[model samples]
Target: MNRRMAVPEQPLLRVRNVSKIYGRSCGECMEGTGPERESNICPKCGSIVAGGPISFDVYPGEILCIVGESGSGKSTLIKSLYFDDTFSSGEVYLQNYEEGKTNLLALSSQKKRRVRNCLMGMVYQNPQLGLRLDFTSGGNNAEKLLTADWHHVGKIRERAQELLARTEIPIERMDDCPKNFSGGMQQRVQISKALANNPSLLLLDEVTTGLDVSVQARVLDLIRQIQRTLGITMIVVCHDFSVIRMLTNRTLVMKNGRVVEAGLTDQILEDPQHEYSQILINSML
Candidate 1:
């Protein structure tokens, strides 16, 4: 007797044909540019196609990494997903929102803000972008919680302490300003704040960049720990393949505003098929 197979799990987040363009598009922009053309610039329209026609799905509790060289559009793709910059075209759906039937891009600003505060979190490469240096570490966490409709000061403070401890930020330092903390500590605080609402999805962009090697290791470990403990889905963008290997289950190699290759992290690292991916992997070696 044949047995019924289990249904595939729905993606926590789905992105379709997303693209971001700078300057007036000429329709031929995508056609005329990319890794094939050795540029993200359109020869005909002089517009930069910073990202797109990119698509992917992130499953629940999975860590997906987008790895690329500078100008490869990895950063643009991440920023677009976070709504830091509007995409010129494409659709994004979250399984937690409207059963993944709604195009998030079509939502009003207020609705988008609610989605960000309630369903998603972002950690930028520069701690300054994710943190208000002058705010005490605990205050930063409270701000996120408040945006997510968290009231009650005592509960907020307690939650802040818990998150700070989870991220390995000393509980004693929760009331101190992040501006005075070391680079790693500031990132820990940022991570705590992003996790304040226990978002189902977290986006991290070059998070360990510019940190000392030891500090980067600690931060990376903290990220892994958080994901394991919280079971949060994550999309991480970075130029560093090592970081991808360390944290991601799947990987996308992007170049010239396009995804050149994607697969399990170990598979891509060991036997990349795309020429660009091969070059990238070789360079890392």
Candidate 2:
């Protein structure tokens, strides 16, 4: 019997009124107020609400960019989505998870990890944070495979070779530690590792931050190639407009831990409505 699977008519990922607070609050800090309330510190209770009640959705096969200056809570949102940091209150739902739509904020640590391994992938701004320099390039990829329960040593190495090749890593250098590669090569290794499991949703956090301009363009091209081939849902955290313009179809502009503007990539570039967004465009021009 041929069985058809049921598909959800919801976004691949969704976040509703998400908030991450850093400091302990008295009972009244978030009282009366809600997700609409921004700015981390509570004047009333002296609690630091570092991020959110932020809201946004990522669709399947769409590249969604999050753009903001430093300390605008963009990083916080990225970390929170992956469960690297705790959120004070919110609901996050991932549609592709086999378990059905679940508020990621409510998942247990073990459950969250399984979800991360199966449904999500992340490449951080710094390779040091994502790739273990001590491990060979292929070994790094093996680590990701192992996380997903691939126990056959030979099969794991074969998968690692395929990922490294896909990301343009030299097969001969697969056994060399990332410490010997240039910055761009190191980032490529990180990308290779991140995609080892073929995750449905990929999160890129400032992946091109410190590379030279030419190298940055090349890295972006590689990312675009991967996105086109995989058609995976992506949430890219970046401040560069060129990155947003080249890689994404939709974008969410964040400031002070809130989504100030959101729309088509061109609309945001040509006709930004929010004041902060205007400033970003103006400076670009």
Candidate 3:
């Protein structure tokens, strides 16, 4: 299933056989013995392989899209990458930091915090996950800046203002609580909060879901503008192919927690070679 797409020699991130199983490990679970791909629950250990033996590369400054329907394990995969959940097995390497030399899963709690705050930013489908609804808009933005060790109060406020404006939130509303915002505005603030540290990687999962269609378009536009303006590497996970077409350079079509197809976004959408990917694209059309 389009197995030979080229990737940069030095990719920004590499996930090798990253796996997450809910129960105990066994030979079948370890080897990812999914006879029916749809069945991630192992008979031997009764462990559910939530995601993986999944592997892929995200190149520098590229938007990588992961698409799959419900129960396809796409959400679990991204959660594992961000350490919102841990993998039962496999290694994740951030380029310039590893070569399978150091395992991210093995990092200390403090070091892991550093990696998440300084190296990556994640925007979840639910704004509450990424934002502090109780805090003022400026306070929410300052929270991330503080996490990255920014101690200058004046500078932090200024940066927060800049980021809020960049996200299209009015500067005057910086003192308002995020809970007061409409769904779309709250999501924008979350985006601003995520971008506060200028992370090298951004993970967006079902970002456009639940918003009004018009609001969705505006958020998408802002996201595209942010990509062009900051050139941040992104991984966007969505069931909607329209979102993928607007955002990604490359894509991985997942089913039952495994990548069934990988290729240029246009190529995969236009002429999907995998049986599952073909069905997904056809349904989208």
TM-score of each: 0.96, 0.91, 0.93
lDDT of 1 by residue, 170-217 (tens): 888989999999999999999999999999999999999999999999
Q: Per-residue lDDT for 12-78 in model 2, tens only? A: 8888999877677775655523324545567787776556678887777788888887767888888
Number of the candidate with higher TM-score, 1 or 2: 1
TM-score sort, best first:
1, 3, 2
Superior by lDDT: candidate 1 or candidate 3: 1
Better of 1 and 3 by TM-score: 1
- The lDDT leader among the candidates is 1
Candidate 1 C-alpha error for residue 195, in Å: 0.3
Name the regions of candidate 2 deviating beyond 4 angstroms: 1-8, 26-39
Candidate 3 structure quality by residue, lDDT tens digits, 1-285: 122345567888888888877876776774544525456777677887777788888887789999987877888988778888888888888875655357787898888788888888899999999888999999999999999999999999999999999999999999999999999999999999989999988999999999999999999999999998898989999988888888888899887767888889999999999989999999997
Clash pairs for candidate 1: none
